[model samples]
Target: MIPIADKYSTFARFYDAMSGEYPVYHAGRNIGISLLRQRPGAQVLDVGCGTGLNFSLLQAQVTQGGTIVGIDRSPEMLVQARRRAERNGWTNIILIQADATALSPAEIGSRIAAEGGRARSDAVLATYALSLMADWETAWANMVSLATPEGSLCVVDMQKPVGLATVLTPLAKAACWLGGSDINAHPWTAVKRDCVDVKAASARGGHLQIRAGTRRAGT
Candidate 1:
């Protein structure tokens, strides 16, 4: 079997078209971005930012003066993300190729700084991406470390559907499996555990979980 990043490199071309964005996954991104509540001129970090799917929503919050740094391990995905930024005439977005779990905070910060972003971001978000990480906790730690003490952190990921949506469990499982994700990952739990004043939401019969909060001191 191919490694996840290598697999995504090939999948990057048709990702936006076939990733179920509109009908399924977009809801989580929308909710997650909303809860971030970033101020104008904020420096935002997007981890595992495949094909820049969160760019539009993040742009609306950060505005022209703000910076949006997008990091992904796959070069092909970064290529698509660059295309998206170019097509939109967005000059404030920076795309970097790096593995979230493997890179240290200093390395990521240095890369961001080299691209004209601040060493620490004002807001950080990961949507539907953490569960794909083999060491998501490390990624989460870097996210926290790369943000200011009181900066916002948001996580959006999938879980088994509940109630009426439970009927779609098989479909959900198949989707997650195809994407190389563990449906039960519940990566947002890290937000609850490490951050304060958490905001939570669910969509698609609880299949998507959104968690956002300010990073607590010493966490």
Candidate 2:
């Protein structure tokens, strides 16, 4: 079997085309970003920001005055992200390649500072990304540490379909399997547990779970 990293690297160029963004995943991100409700000039961090799919939506919220720091483990993926940023003439984006679960927050904060962003962002988002990590909780902790005291947090991930959507279970599992994600991971639960005033939404027949909220103090 191809290693996950290699798989991502090899597939980076084709990821957006095969990712089912329009039909399946985009709704979750839309809900998550809408719930985040960031203001103009806000700084945002996107973990596992593959091909910068969230960039356009985030840009709509933060505008040109704001900063966007995108982190992903695959260098090839970062390349695609950078290309997307350049293609749209978005100069406010800072792409970094690193393992989200293992990075040092201080170091990453410093790096962001070097790129003209604040030490901590005003908002943090992860879409269809966390479930790919075996140690997703550690990544979640890092996300918290990289945000401001009351920064907005959003997580969008997948699960088995429910109710009438149960008929799509096999397709959902196939997509998750192709992406090397644990469909049962339920990483958004951490957001619900650790964040306050959490807003929840689901789409695609409950196959997509989205949670957004403010970071609790001292968390």
- Residue 179 of model 1 has an lDDT of 89
Over the stretch 125-185, how does candidate 1's per-residue lDDT look in tens digits? Answer: 9998899998999999999999998999999999999998999999999999888998877
C-alpha TM-scores of all predictions: 0.98, 0.98
- State the C-alpha lDDT per candidate: 0.94, 0.93
Estimate candidate 2's RMSD in Å. 0.7
Name the 10 consecutive residues with the lowest summed lDDT in model 2.
110-119
Provide the lowest-lDDT 10-residue window in model 1: 1-10
Error of 2 at 30 (Å): 0.8
